[model samples]
Target: MATEVSSRLFYHFLGALKRTHSFSNFSFPLGLPQTSMSYSASKTWISPQTKELETWTKIRDSIMRISPRSPFIPKTFADWLEHRLAIKEDQLRKVVRKIARISGRDDRQETTIHPVLGVKEIEDRRALVLARETIWRQSLESFPGRRLAPWPSYEEYKHEGDDRSKSGYRRFLPLPRDPGNVTVNWKQRKPLPQYLFDEVGRRTTVDNEEDKEPGLDELLAMEFVGASLILLLDS
Candidate 1:
């Protein structure tokens, strides 16, 4: 009975989604669906969970294509993304300060915070995480590594130096990179300093009490938007 409902939602999802999804046929000018975007996994028949996944995947993918720069960006995600970016910017500035201080260079005003760089990072991260969390929640709610696929095993790749005796099957375990890892742009030749990834002992760095922060109204607004998150999930 549950499978019947799931199947219905999945079919409706396909019809409703064709128009809005980032991975839809229209998204690719070449008329090719994205490599990992298709719903079919095994046989012609999809299971109940796969149906639920397809339904949620369509919805999540639809929301991700929305642009903050667009005139019609939904208010809630924008508010959340904006607030997150502001918080991250503050953190990035502190990192830049530490890097500058450690370089034996006097803290020049320009190096303190590059406004353009901060804006670029915030925009990029906002888009990526918005896509990420949308997909993550969808997949996690549905269940992972089943019906769809599992992480590839070590036997999937061949390396010259690896020894099967000592390495055992452990060498075959998938070592996936984190999607949120800092991406270095070789074309721009911009490198984030190493300290950014370094572990800080138990000591917590706190901003001075006198430092100004964005008003309560701003944080209140983001929280207010978050309160309506169910609507977003359903949308």
Candidate 2:
């Protein structure tokens, strides 16, 4: 792919030279096949042209780095290019908008809106209790078919006459016929602090008799997880 592009550019340069005074320096006639020329003659014309084309290709690629199609263009380079060209903010924004529309691209600056996280403290104890209860009930009720059953048992029969009621096989089945429902025994916990720092302090306090005090590392980890859980539940 690269070789083909270079060859095309070289030929185009040669065509452009036909109109200029530099055409005579290219020793061979344009009409003749390149194979017909001596190695030295072809080398004389091709080498300089190849070098010139490579330089031009490098310059073109540098310019193209600012283009939306170039996948690997760095942000710093793009910024530098815009500054060097004295591009206005509006012009740049317009270019970005057009590129986004054409390529279905999402520019973080224009497209992304980060959600604002605000922790609203639960002032009412009743509300928190209700929420906990609702969540627990929902979890328990979600799987209606789940039930506890006894393990199967089996016993050998002595004779055919001993299987009078034909209940010998019944021993192999689960003993209990009734389906046991799920129950959640939610232990009431002391209220968390209105402020996050107070909550962390309270959790780490060895003086509190109602709850077990965690180690320093464990307290920090619990605080982090608790904060995340509160945010998730609130949302």
Q: Model 2: how far is 75 from its true place, Å?
A: 22
- Candidate 1 accuracy as TM-score: 0.16
Per residue, candidate 1 scores C-alpha lDDT tens digits across 79-179 of: 43343344455656776788888997755755565664356443212224322212222233322321222333344334312654356644543333222
The predictions' CA RMSDs to the true structure, in order, are 29.1, 25.6
- Per-residue lDDT tens digits for candidate 2, residues 1-235, read 6445545554454454432223323343334333334655644334544443344445456666657566554334333333322333444567679878978854555765654234554432212432321212213232233342222223222222335346554223222223332231111212221322223344344666657654545555655668677567759
Off by over 4 Å in 2: 13-17, 21-235
> Over 4 Å off in model 1, which ranges?
1-75, 105-235
Q: Residue 86 error for model 1, in Å? A: 0.6
- Most accurate candidate by TM-score: 1
Give TM-scores for every candidate, taking all chains together and pairing residue i with residue i: 0.16, 0.12
Candidates in order have lDDT scores of 0.40, 0.40
